[model samples]
Target: MFGRSKDSTAPADQAPALTEEPLGTVELPGGKGRPTPKRKTAEAANRRPLVPQDRKAAAKEARAAQRAERDRQYAAMQTGDEKYMPAKDKGPVRRYIRQYVDARWSLGELFLPVAIVMLLLNMLLTSVSPELAFLGLVVLYLFIIAMVVDVVIMWRRLRKKLAAKFGDAGQQRGLMMYAVTRVFQIRRARLPKPQVKHGDYPE
Candidate 1:
């Protein structure tokens, strides 16, 4: 028992060498030898510049969108939808101006088409007879004065109303011009088309 050994252990250096299996040259589907990039970088690399023809197509689409917007605005003006109205057509002041104009009858309302007719008539008269044309001119000037006076009267009343309502609102910049423009437009043809009828004044 003293001369014999019961068991024996292997030496550390002589133990089996552990070998890791080689990962068999893994390849990316389409990117041989390339590093994998972030999503945004990959997307940017795929984006193409717009050529002339592509630009034209984009412009056409833009124009179509603009036309659709214009049509919507026109429809809103016709129906008086305050939500989608143009700047000039929006606000309580403009609405009041419309009511003021629509509440009364004015010869100024017929000024546009009538002035065109008068101009043509004047031209015709001028070609036929100078004296008749001169007379026509005088009459035309008088009519223009009357229209001007009508607008002035309208403006005076509008100013008073605006002062009473808005109290010197800085937005009154184009209010007179707005009122004058509306006066030139026919009542039935006014945009945001007159919610009030004749004789609905002093409100």
Candidate 2:
């Protein structure tokens, strides 16, 4: 048989030689260089809803949160927690005033009860004699005058003490009125329940 040309193989079944690329030189299409997200993570992102679907339920929850907050503040006020006190009652000066006022007996504390008793007695006296009823009115007026004088005196003394302890800022606007109003309220009913016992005035 005649020898085949060198270019032609006896059998053309041999596979082409494989070539290896230099390390780190091969590039992948569409690669972003980030690790692939797990299936659970991808599914969670897709399932999350931006807004609540139940609007009414959301509104109710908001109101419940507000009410809870309000109740918490009320409890704090009753306990005299300075951090949660109302604007009117906050500050060290206010606390000092409260302690000072609570430590002493105030005629104003009895004014309400005395006035009620006088009114009832006067009503009964009016049925018995007009003159007695007139006398009752005069007594009530005198008692009122006395109560006013006592309050004025108390304020003057307290003002001096306040100035000594806290300077001019202690006698701040609305502070006097705040103290006066508290004086009128029965000690047992006062808010921010008295921290000091009678005669235990603040230094």
State each candidate's clash count. 0, 0
Cα lDDT tens digits, model 1, 18-124, are 98754444465664744567899999999887566577788999999999988888888888788888887888888888888988898898787778887888899
**Model 1 quality (TM-score):** 0.66
User: Best TM-score goes to which candidate?
Assistant: 2
| TM-score (C-alpha) between model 2 and the true structure | 0.69
Worst lDDT window (10 residues) for model 2?
A: 23-32
Q: The CA-based lDDT of model 2 is what?
A: 0.85
Displacement of residue 71 (Cα, Å) in model 1 is 1.2
Candidate 2 residue lDDT tens string, 32-91: 545667899999888967789998999999999989887877787789898876777888
